[model samples]
Target: MFNISEVDKGDSDLARLVSELDVFLSELYPVESNHCLDLSAVSDEQLRCVIVRDEGNAHAGCGALLFHQNGSAEIKRVYIRPEYRGKKLGEKIVSAIEGIVSEKNSRLLQLETGIHQQPAIALYRKCGYEICDAFPPYTADPLSVFMRKELP
Candidate 1:
C-alpha cells in the first residue's frame, strides 16, 4: 500500500518525479509530439499535484491536476517509478486526483497522454475516461490521445 498526499509543485520529491517523467517522455516521443507542461506552467497556482509514497516515505510516483477558470480540470504529470509499476499505483493516483476534483465540484477531468502509451491509455479507459476531441491549448495532434470523464 502507498500513501497519497497533495503537494506543491516545488516539493522536492514531486519535482524529481516530474523531471523523471519529462525525461521518460523525451525518450519515447519526438519534440513535437511531446506536449508536457513545463515547470513554470506546473508552478501556476491553478495547478495542484499529488505524490504517492511507500510506507518508508520514498517517492513512488506523482500526478497533477490543472484547474481552469471553468468547471474543468486537466490531469497531468502522472508517473510511477519503474519498480513501482504493475502495483496499480497509477490507478490509485488517478483516483486520488479525482477525489480532489470532486471536492472542487469540477464537472469534468481530462488528460492528454501520448499515443504510444498503451498502458496509460488503458488505465484511463478503465477509470471511465473516453477518447474525446482535443480541448483548449491542445490541437489535434496525431501523437496525442485526449480523454475525459464526467464526474458524478
Candidate 2:
C-alpha cells in the first residue's frame, strides 16, 4: 500500500527529496532556466506540500502548491524518486495538489518545466494541463515549457 498526505516542505525527508530534484534539474538546464524554489521559499507557511510514502512508510516522492492572490496557483517541487517512478505516484501527487486547489477555491493551476523534460510535460498533459504562454514572474525562454489547467 502507499499513502499520500499533506506535509510541511521543511520535513527532513521531503527536504532530501527536494535537494535531489534540484540537482536533477541543475544538470539538465542552466541556472536561469531552472525555476525551482529554494528551500526557504518552498518552506513558507502558506505553501502547501504533500509527500508519498510506501507501505513501509518510506518517503517516495513529494510535490507542492504556491497560491497566488489572484485565485490561481503554481505547482512546484513535484519530484518522484528515480527508483519509484513507474508506479503512478506522480499522478497521485498531482491529484492531491488539485484537491487542495479545489478546497482553496482556486480554478487555475499552472507550472513551468524544462523544455527537455518530455516525461514531465507528458504527465502534465495527461493530467489536463495545456501548454500556455509564460505567466507572471516568468518570461518566454527557449528552455522553458509553461502549462496551465482550468478546473471546474
Candidate 3:
C-alpha cells in the first residue's frame, strides 16, 4: 500500500525526491523554462509539502502547494518516481493537494509545466485543470504550459 501525507520540506526523502525532479526537468527544458522552486523556497512557511511512501516506507513521490494571500495557491514540485508511474499515484497527489487547497479556502489553484511534459498536462486535464493564460509572476513562454482550476 501507498500512503500520502503532509511532511516537512526538510524531510530527507522529500528533498531527495525534489532533487530528482529538478534534474529531470533540467534535462528536458532550459533553465528559464524550468519554473520549479528551489529547495529553499519550497521550505518556506507558505508552502505545504506532501510525500508518498510505500508499505515499507520507501519514498515514491512528492508534491507541494504555495499559498498566496489572495486565497489562491499554486501547485508545485509534483513528481512520481519513474518506477512508480502508471499506478494512479499522480492523481492521488493532485487530489491530496486539492484537499489542502479547499481547507485553506483557496479560490483558485494553478500550475506551470513544460510543454514537453505531455503526461503531466494530461494528468492536470484529467483532474479538471484547464489550459489558461500565464498567471501573475509568470510571463508567457513558448515552452511553458499554464493551467488552472477554480475551487468550489
Candidate 4:
C-alpha cells in the first residue's frame, strides 16, 4: 500500500530528495526565476512537509504547505523521484496537502511554478488550481506562472 504522511524535513532521506529537486530546478531555470524553497525554509514550524512511501517503505515523493497568518497556504517543494513519476502520485500529494490545508483552516492555497513545467502545471490544474495573478514575493515574471485554488 502507498502511505502519505507528514515527515521531518531534516530527515536524511527526505533531505536528499530535496537536494535533488533543487539541482533539477537549478538546471531547468535561471537562479533569478526559480522560487523553489530550500530545506531550511521548509523545515520552518509554519510549513508542513509530507513524504510518500510505498509498501516496501521506499520514498516515492514529497511536498509541503507554507502556512501564512492570513488563513492561506502555499504549496511548495513538490518533488517525485524520477523513477516514480506518471503514477498519479503528484495528484495524490497535492490532495494530501489540501486535506492538511483544510484542517489548518486555510481558505486558499496558492503556488508558483515555471512556465516550462508543463507536467506540474497540468497536475495543479487537475487538482483544481487555476491561473492567478502574482501574489506577494512574486511578480510579473514572464517565466513564472501563478495558480491558486479556494478550499471548500
Look at candidate 3 and tell me the lDDT of residue 73. Answer: 95
List clashing residue pairs in candidate 2: none
By TM-score, the candidates rank as: 3, 2, 1, 4
Clashing pairs in 4: none
Full-model lDDT for every candidate: 0.91, 0.90, 0.92, 0.88
| Total clashing pairs in model 4 | 0
What local lDDT score does residue 11 receive in model 4, on the 0 to 100 scale?
76
RMSD of 4: 1.3
Question: Of 1 and 4, which scores higher on TM-score?
Answer: 1
In terms of TM-score, how similar is model 1 to the real structure? 0.95
TM-score of each: 0.95, 0.96, 0.96, 0.94
lDDT of 3 at 95: 96
Residues 2-84 of candidate 2 have per-residue lDDT tens digits of 89999876689889889999999999999878898875654464599999999999999999999886779999999999989
Clash pairs for candidate 1: none
Candidate 2 whole-model C-alpha lDDT, 0 to 1: 0.90
* lDDT of prediction 3: 0.92
Q: lDDT per residue, candidate 3, 17-86, as tens digits?
A: 9999999998999988889887575447689899999899999999999987777899999999999999
- Cα miss at 129, model 3 (Å)? 0.3
Worst 10 residues of 1 by lDDT: 37-46
Global Cα lDDT for candidate 1? 0.91
Cand. 3 TM to true fold: 0.96
Clashing pairs in model 3, backbone N/Cα/C closer than 3 A: none
